[model samples]
Target chain A: MKAWLRFSTSIVNKSVISDIMKLFDIDFNILKADITPRGGKMLVEIDGPQASESISYMEDKGIEVTPILKVVKKDTDKCLECGACVSLCPVEAISILDDWDIDIDNQKCIGCGFCISSCPTQAIALME
Target chain B: MKTIEEINQKIKNGDAVVVTAAEMTLIAKDKDIKTVAEEIDVVTTGTFGAMCSSGVFFNFGHSDPPIKMNKTYLNGVEAYSGLAAVDAYLGATQPNHDLDIGLDYGGAHVIEDLVRGKEINLMTEAYGTDCYPLKKIKAPITLENINQATMVNPRNCYQNYAAATNSTQETLYTYLGTLLPNYGNVTYSSAGELSPLLNDPYFQTIGIGTRIFLCGSAGYIIGEGTQHFTEAERHHGVPITPSGTLMLKGDLKKMDSDFVRGATMPSYGPTLFVGAGIPIPILNEDIALRTSISDEDIGCKIFDYGVPRRTRPVIKETNYQELKSGKIEINGREVPTSPLSSYKRAVKVAEELKKWIQKGEFLLSNPVDLLPNKGQLVKPLNIIKPPKMVCDIERKPVIITHPTDPVKEVAKKLVDNDINHLPVVDKNGKLKGIVTSWDIADAVARGKTKLEEVMTKKVIIAREDEPVDIIARRIDKNDISGLPIIDKDNKVKGMITAEDISRLIGKKNNK
Candidate 1:
């Protein structure tokens, strides 16, 4: 199971992540993280029986935790299909179709959210 | 050879052999231009891309009390209200006045919304006059309520455009979409052979009043577009760079949202993605020859947009064939290429136009005036360097003042020396500030007695040996009529006024 974690300024520097990692014998992998001294967000994949409990532990540490539901969604109405996000997509998940409209393959997408940010019209949304 | 009228007659008769520019390319592969010209009546073309130089002018019928509106805004995005009362021009790229919400919604969205029959927040301000007394208005307006909604794009239908790539270490966001750093990506926007101006490379058939497809609706070519490049060198008949632009006009009410969309570039702001196309009337073999030109034959310079300036270095010259192939090489490194302009949509537009012509719904008009010949020099806006220095032009006595001095004393000194400008100096004769005749008049009008109260405190001073041109520009830009000339120690040595610069021009011209 994948989980989204937000580190607020108060608990941002805490070593509770390492504490949870030690407490749980789960397959843990940090997928993406953007951090500053103030605060930031991170996406992680944690598998095994203690995944849910480890999330609860991080929640108690004041790190906002939410289960990763899906990778990204493209709002077709807002997309101009200009292909501004195609070259910037590292996974080659976003592509232009024969009709010149954009197509996003969630299976190929690593949930990096680069397409969501590179989109000119803010057409892509990360699924909560 | 068939004339435009003959093509129109055939179009109305439902027997015109009209095909798309894309189809024409494939047909021309087997047949020659002369044979194609003899058979085809018209070759339709299309392009859908971000046209930043696009806007709609609205003429809202007068309100109950009527207002000579000088400032107008639609959905918080300001419009150019310089025209008659209640009429305003909303540019496509004009961002919202409310910076927070406006980053997404702007003039382009307003136009798209208006076309979608969505109600807009129409706001206006006026200085109440006798005949037109309404001071302000804030109301909801729809396309149905406005008297006129016309899209008048000053520039569109680029003949061709250079592809853009970045050589820098960081990603670059430009009109050519997002360019990856270190030549990681290349982006181009023209629709190659399908481009309207490219098919009519010499503009033999397209001209003023030539009918066209604008936003999925009928429009007309107005004239030469702004920054219309007449001087670009050509390969065969097509330009190697961005050239020939069209001034376009159409009824906004007839436009479809599918063809006219409001889009925003992540960090680059808003632009209107307009779907446009034009039909080339096969009047002669030349027309057929131009239309037969294909993507592979067209070449475009790839410019390094990494250097942000008026002119960027050309990376290499490549053609649309390689560009559409999805990759190209820069500095011997493989770089992916993307088209910000959708060729699929361009083909769709061309098909739509072709269907319209085949169905006898649209007819071609003979150009009232053809587009002008090419080879107008692409001139840069060069800032001329004037060859005279302040000390070289001649000198005048330094008009000095003290900070604590009274306004009357400065007025007396100005009147005695027949000067209107005075540079305020300190006890050690260092330049402190400046005061003008206008300052004294302002002092009396505001009832100020102290010179410092009326004098400009943060003075703009120039050096004696500096170019008079630089000092003259400084004075003009600062909105001050004069500037104090000081020495290395900051002591006021002299003063140069607008009048002095005017005199220097006369002297230089005479010499």
Candidate 2:
């Protein structure tokens, strides 16, 4: 199971993620991360039968954990392919194809919502 | 040169070789302009962008009592009802006032609903008259129920537009999309080589009455659009400044929702995404050459939008090729670029236009009139205080005299009021001329005592609503110390002097 985790400045310095890893037999992979002295966000893929339990345990420790059902979903019917969302993506997930259609790689999207609000047409949405 | 009639005839016969501007560039690389012009009868061009000046006019068949709709709403969005009793014009950018949909739906959504064959809630309010007794009416309406539904756009398909970037330390949300703080990204809105106006840069083959593909339907160019600046600097007839726009009119019933979309920008309200395509008849070699223009040849200036002024300074002049490359160097930093206009949709529009022409469903029309090759210079709006003269008698009594009055009396009045200028008026109190002390002295030297003879006949008067800066400039240009302020009826209202302007400036500086 994959999820996006948000940590506040106080919790960011703490080893809550490592504590969760040790408490549960869960293998975690940091797909993407952005950590500042203030606070940060991370996209992690947690593997194990107790992935749900590990996420719950992290929530109990004051770490915000949101499970990722679909990272990003683009409404093609509403999309004008204006490329307004391409540059704001932290990862190079959104790109213009040869035909100039804006393509977003859901695999590379970290669900940052940077492209969502940046989109003038409001065609891109972050799906949890 | 081949005429549009000849090209249309070839199109009717399914013998006209038509290609999109993109396809024509490839053909032009292999063959000369003359050969390409001879082979191709028409070249299709297109643009898909957020055209804010778009609207749809709908003629809903009269109600039972035929109420004059003074106010209207379509799916909670207000539609302009100033046209006729039942006719209404729904602007693309009108926001949904009644619905708290987070500004997601608007007039464009109503248009899309109509295009998609969905019923829209039509509500109108009118003051009940004797003949039209109904005051308020609410009903569901569809495109089929309407007598006429046409998309009338004042401006579409700009030849070129500015690329936008933010220089400020904070992120800015503008019509150019989101501009990240500290020049994080640059955004431009144009289809580059695929744009319709770019392909017919000079308006040689496209003008009034020229048929076009508008949102998947056949439409016509009505005239040169609003803010159409044709004389902007050009490279190969392609404008570097935003110029050569087109006014388009088409039936909304025939349009597809896929091409015409309602777009809502965060905090900017609603705007229409219009897909426009114009097929240029290869009338001559020049037309062929113009159609073959590529992204490398078309260029525009990147403007810094952080200045928050109409006249923002240009950061750099860059071609469409560099813009399309997705990254540009701005202030020594590698800034990513995004296009607000969709080239894919533009290409799709062009291809669809070509198909329509090939199938004889569309025909090109010769221009009824040509757009002027030149445009007037655009001046920035000067911010100045509105002219408000002190009409109180304590400040300064306006020295005045009738035109038939003696020049000696005007001179006496000027001296008595301790003023340098006096306004000469007629019996009806209309300002006739202005007589200065120097003019009165000159007239006395010439042995003329009549006020009309002494007064300056060519007087540049300032209006009551005129800006102070413009009046000041007039005073400076004429080398005059004062000007007579007049009302709309030409009656002398008051007088403004250079001293008064300087006093106002001093006051402003103090603040």
Candidate 3:
């Protein structure tokens, strides 16, 4: 199961993921991480029989967790490919092709929803 | 030097060579302008950006009952239906007023849907008359069913524009995209090198009746755009303060959905993304030089959005090269920059236009009327004191309220007097604070009953004898609709509003 975890500034220094791994017997792999003193966000894939239990434990420990059940989808019918969403992506997931078409990498996208709000055409949506 | 007619004849005969303005830059760097002019018959220029002033006019075929649409909405977004019985104009910026997701849908979306050959839900209402018996009509309409759908814009491509940055701590969401707080990023919106007006800076080749590439179809320039300031300071024939603009006309049926898109700013509502291209005939050396202008030569000032004024202070004057570099130095800080306009699309448009000319599918037309060289000076409205009118203190007593007054009573007094503002004063007639209708409404919503709790303690006041111009400027600068006029003793005398200033201006104009 893939999930996105948000860590507040105070809890950012804690080894919550290691604690979860030891207590729940789940193998966790960090996909992407953007941690700063202000706050931090991490996209991780937790694989185990107790993945759901580990996620619940993380949320109970004051860590915000959202399951990665959806991927960013671009509607070719409505998208203008203006690249307005290219700069808003925190993970360089949205990029402009050689022909000027805006491409979104589903694998790189963390489903942050930042590009969805900034899109003027409302062409990009997080689809389950 | 070859005339424009000769260049057009060569293009018509497929004997002329054409290159994009961006390509012309590289060609001219190696050769002289005269040589480039003689070699290239046409230089293509383009701009792809959010054009909010764009709209489409539709002549909906009459229904069986022949209904006259006075009010119309396409997918809950309002369309202007005041032209004729069946004719309507849908502006790109019209919000979906009645829908909860109104901001997400607008006239631009309707046009895009139409261009994609999709049926649109149209709802219209009209008063039944003797000739037209229908009162209301709701149906699905498509481009094929409509008689005529023309896109007429008051302003299309601006020659140049200012860069916007935020110096405040809070993020600012504006037409320039999101401006990060503390000068974190800057955003600009011009196509720079590929822009039409930038290539033909003096309106040399582009004017009324000139054909252009509009949203993947051919369109024509109708007239000068609104606020076309041709007399601004110029460098290499391009004005820094958006000197020239174009009024364009095109057929909606011929436009492609790929070039024309619907866009919604979070709080600013909807706008249309327009992709346009124009071909400049290289008739002379000067025209070739103008088209060959590079990004290094085109510069725009960076304005601080924190100032909150029409005349924002210029922090730096940087060229498009620095602007496109993704980071620029502002006040010793290297701030990230973003462009609202798509340069990639703009280049694609220019290249496509060049291909059209090279294939002899497109030709150039001479201007029916050239734009004015000198722009009329915008005069500020002066504060003219009428001989019969006296100072603010000599006027009728202003409506006042006490701090001890109940919120309900203050609200009632405001409604009864049809006034939105009231100055709170003491028993000795000294001003204490002020209350507005917003305060009363907020108090009512919050279930507050005391006037003191709802009123603003720091009141903005104006002197009785102060010049109306200064007061009006102050009101405008502060974004306040009105201010309370006070005497020397800090007593409330009267009030002045934006309406009063407008009325004074109207009276002066009448005189």
Give the number of the best model, judged by DockQ: 2
lDDT of 3 at B220: 94
Tell me the tens digit of each residue's lDDT in model 1 across B1-511.
8888888989999999989998898998998778888999999999999899999999988998999888898999999998888889999999999979775888888999999999999899998889989999988999998899999999887889989999765677777778786788988889898888888888888889999999988999998888788778778778899988989999999998888988787667788988899999998988898898899889899999976657789999999989877778888887777788778778878999999999999999877898776655556776686457777757777679898999999999999999999999999999878899989999999999999888888777777767777677667756888888888798888988888899989987898
Top-down TM-score ranking: 2, 1, 3
For model 3, residues B372-445, the per-residue Cα lDDT tens digits are 65754434455485422216323545799999999999989989988888999999989998899999999999
Q: lDDT tens string, model 2, B52-159?
A: 899998899899977989989998899989877899999988888765774688887788789999999999999978888899999999999889998999988887
**Model 3: what is its DockQ?**
0.30
Q: For residues A1-128, what per-residue lDDT tens digits would candidate 2 score against the true structure?
A: 67889999888788888888788988898877888889988888888888889888889877899887678889887788989888777788899998788899877776778888867566788664
| Model 2 local distance difference test score | 0.84
Each candidate: what lDDT? 0.85, 0.84, 0.82
Say which candidate scores most in lDDT: 1
**Docking verdict class for candidate 3:** acceptable
User: What TM-score quantifies how close candidate 2 is to the native fold?
Assistant: 0.74
Regions of model 3 farther than 4 Å from truth: A1-18, A21-79, A86-111, A126-128, B376-511
Give lDDT tens digits, candidate 1, residues A1-128.
66778998998778988999899877888878887989998888778889888888888899998876567888877777777777778777777776667788765667887777777678899886
* Residue B89, candidate 1: C-alpha displacement in angstroms: 1.1
Q: How many Å off is the CA of A79 in candidate 1?
A: 1.6
List pairs with backbone clashes in candidate 2: none
